[model samples]
Target: RDNADNTYTESGTRKRMGRKGIGKLAALSVAERVKVISVRDGDKSGCILSLNISNKNADGKYEIPAIPDDQINFLKIDETKSGSAIIMENSRYSINKTIDSAKRNISLIFPFACQTFKIHLENLTTGATATIDDTTMDIVKLSDALLTFSDEDSEYNEYLNALHGAFDNGRYYRVLQEKLPPDQLPAQKVLHKALTTIKEKMLLVTITGEQKAFDLSICGWIATFASSSDKKRNTDFPVNHISIIANDKLGQFDILPDISTDRMGEAYVVGQFFVDLLEETELPDIAASNRQGYKEDDPRFEKTLELIRKNALRPILELKADATKEKNYIRDLEKANKAKESKEAFDRSIREVVEHPDFKKVIHDSQPVKQALETAWELKDTLKDTYKKIMISHSSDDKPVIDELERVLHFCGFEKEEILYSSSNYYESGFEAYTDIYDYLKNFFVNTTRKTDLCVIYILNQGFVEKWDPVLEAGAGWVLNSTWYPMYTDTFSSVRRPFPGTAYTPKLNFDMDEKQSRTLAGAIYRISQHAGKLEQTEETIFQFIKTTRLYHG
Candidate 1:
């Protein structure tokens, strides 16, 4: 099976054999869109066939309707050969396929395919692979191998095409449905229409796994898919079986969407679908949960279940309109004659805080200070929230260590915007290479985390303890260190690691009061932990933060 040297007339014991169906399935099991081609031995020509399944057609009813000649960009399939020789270009045919940081990952899963074809997956952002075997891989054979006749989603698209109603769309749902932004996803009508269909016509959907890393345009597709469809007596689309099977619950394993014996299967299917996507995707998990209020079989949520049942579309719209009107009325009243008095009261508060000796010293750094001030002002200007954002305190010498720390935060579900990077463009003057150190402290008075949450600190070897003025100043400041601050090693924030002949020393130095990773993770797990729910300034600026003293030892 390793080589194809025996594919000729056998004089004594030589023989030829064809490829197995298992290989065909392996080729088809790819994550996204896959096209196959083939050319068998002794054939003069070959053909091209593209067989693909997408989250767009999770209901399993759609197929390649034939690409219009004008829309064809980079493919020219020849249908004249028979010995099987196919070419796959991992280019623009897909975005997730274009290589980036996860190159080593893709190759590990498809090693045989990679080695056989001598294809190398390069950068995670834009790289690809090519495979060549003794057997020809032409388009027609490849397509045939991937194609599976499925009629399950026959009414999928049609039912989805008409889901407008009183709960999902509400009164304005129809009007807004017609007014989707020009750059939005396709089949707006169908997707919205499926919202209230009682026949259970939707199925064959995909979540694509990387929903956490894509653009809003793509995420919108998943939102629409999850929203508009009415729960059918027939089914709830399972989250498993997609190219990306990261969904933690509800596949073909435990229950079928159509099982008549279990009435609550629908709840399990939908709730688990959400839990799976919430694992890493960037969707609004809280809002989605709040609206539907469904989760792992909790009886206490009976009221939530009632809301889900009564939901049609119009009532939701009514509620949204009422909320918006109430917000506007409050704003208008504030803008009237009462505005001048309120402004004086507000300005007095600012002066009282700024003029206080305690605040004056807590604020005012040469680098992070300026940016913090600006961010604070913006937060105050838009007083919708009480606190503005989460501020991180770090010294310039600890850039590399802090950089790595940032990566960890993002890895564990924290957003960069949620945690202010003191090294960003906060100061615009003599502090060009060095942003103002005092900006953040000035902003602290307005709303510490209105624009963000969960402030963190990165410590480095001899950086802070060795009398680094910036770190020392920050540690003693009021606004920067106001509340819960989880500290990390300099390497967590720094970009550099052990240089040429060094001892590979990576250590962070700070207080000795820090707790375990789990303890800190619970206290400051992510930015969302404190967003739209509470103010960041709840903790005193003078509160003592638990930290760990570090050394090369």
Candidate 2:
């Protein structure tokens, strides 16, 4: 206890994390008595410590009681190794409570869990034991990108390897937008120079009341960035933090609040920095009494914060910005290519149907046939896919409900290609976005063959009844005499025809409830039966609908 002071000289290579004697009193909070046992220089020793805050001696201080050596060795101490253990006796909570809380709490306080030193918690009552190790950190598990800075060569190489691994696996960026040629991207050498520059700076601070200068340098740190901030589910501790570690012990849980600019980019950032100088005994104690963080006014801490803000955090944000731009550029290119390919496929399908043997073998010499063929040319622009048995007609604003409707269709034994929705990929029949709407509808309803085979599900809402596009789709479905069903939310009731005609059938309710479930299931069953595609039983369909939530809006 006498050696516990501001200066540490216990070990040449390792710095002690606990210098104050306050930690020895922590067990007294939860236990009436504690058994201390140790093995040093092949000699075994034991003692019993008992403290009561409510009781005080005549000297106005708590009295420590001593017990026999036999009573102190309650748990067998291993004399084979030089070590120490304190067993809290008559604790307020039992080992069962410790088992539940130890894993997460211990991992947080002692985050440097490694194979060289491992802490195991065992329940003496049930003989259940758990070990805390390096895997508990989960720092590198699901990170999108990581940058490590260290002055040492081995540590720097290790960090470089991790960065390269993330890049190669396509996890370095949420979206890999590298559309430009490889030559255009920054070379690895240039990036290495830029990233490694973080460890080059040193901080100089004057020791208070001594007129002596102290040089401070960062030991190492790891910075992580993720695409999403919802990483608490994957970690045992608070995420998106920049913790400060001094002498292998956590000095501050997070320093980001003090140093951050609070930019949107900061949401993706998380890291830890190590600065042993914060705990240097030769210098004045800069850490707060709680030992959780350094004094804000301390020159040493202020400089360290400035160093991290400029060198460590800023570069990662710049890299994220560059990666995001690249991602968007590549996405645009892919969309453009997809649209072009769809347009070409639409042209090919129309030409194939128009030049079919049935249409080509007509007697052109007849005046009536010639006039009919001429009329057919004007309506031949309509697109058709015989495999598409269902068409979902709804306003673009009602996409959410249409999504649920698609799910129901899929559950009822319909493939993605067997249905058509303007917003979905199944509507690849033509360039619906670029083509003339009136001409396309005219050819689809009035010229297309086998109108009775198609079934349209119109999702009726205020957006649908008021929008010109959805109204046109509804009118086309009616004119073709195609089997159609109208579903509406509370926002609207009856369907208003696009051309002033009325639909006689009642609109099915689309709210998310038991009644809607039964109504939707029955409608789906009947539609499937009409299309000769009935696969799922009515009960099975109802059960599936029970698990899903339909429209609530």
- The model with the greatest lDDT is 2
TM-score of each: 0.29, 0.50
Task: Tell me the alpha-carbon RMSD of every candidate.
Answer: 24.5, 14.5
Best by TM-score: 2
Candidate 2 per-residue C-alpha lDDT over 1-553 given as tens digits, one digit per residue, 9 for 90 to 100: 1133534556655667755756656677778887777767666677667765455689997755444545534244555657777877898655335564666566666766667668787777878778887532365555544556654453334544444444322542324324456654433221122144243333443334445555566644444444574454433456677878787778898888887754456676777667776777666677687767889998778888888887777666555544444445456457647855876697699778667877666654577976776677665544543456777787777676667677667667565665767766455533356777676566556643454556787877766668888778887887767778777654334455542323333234445666656667777888777666666766667665654456343
**Which segments of candidate 1 are over 4 A away from where they belong?**
1-239, 242-388, 407-415, 424-435, 443-461, 467-469, 479-481, 490-520, 526-553
Tens digits of per-residue lDDT, candidate 1, 445-505, equal 3444323333434344435545554454355433443443434453344323221212322
Q: What is the C-alpha lDDT of each candidate?
A: 0.33, 0.62
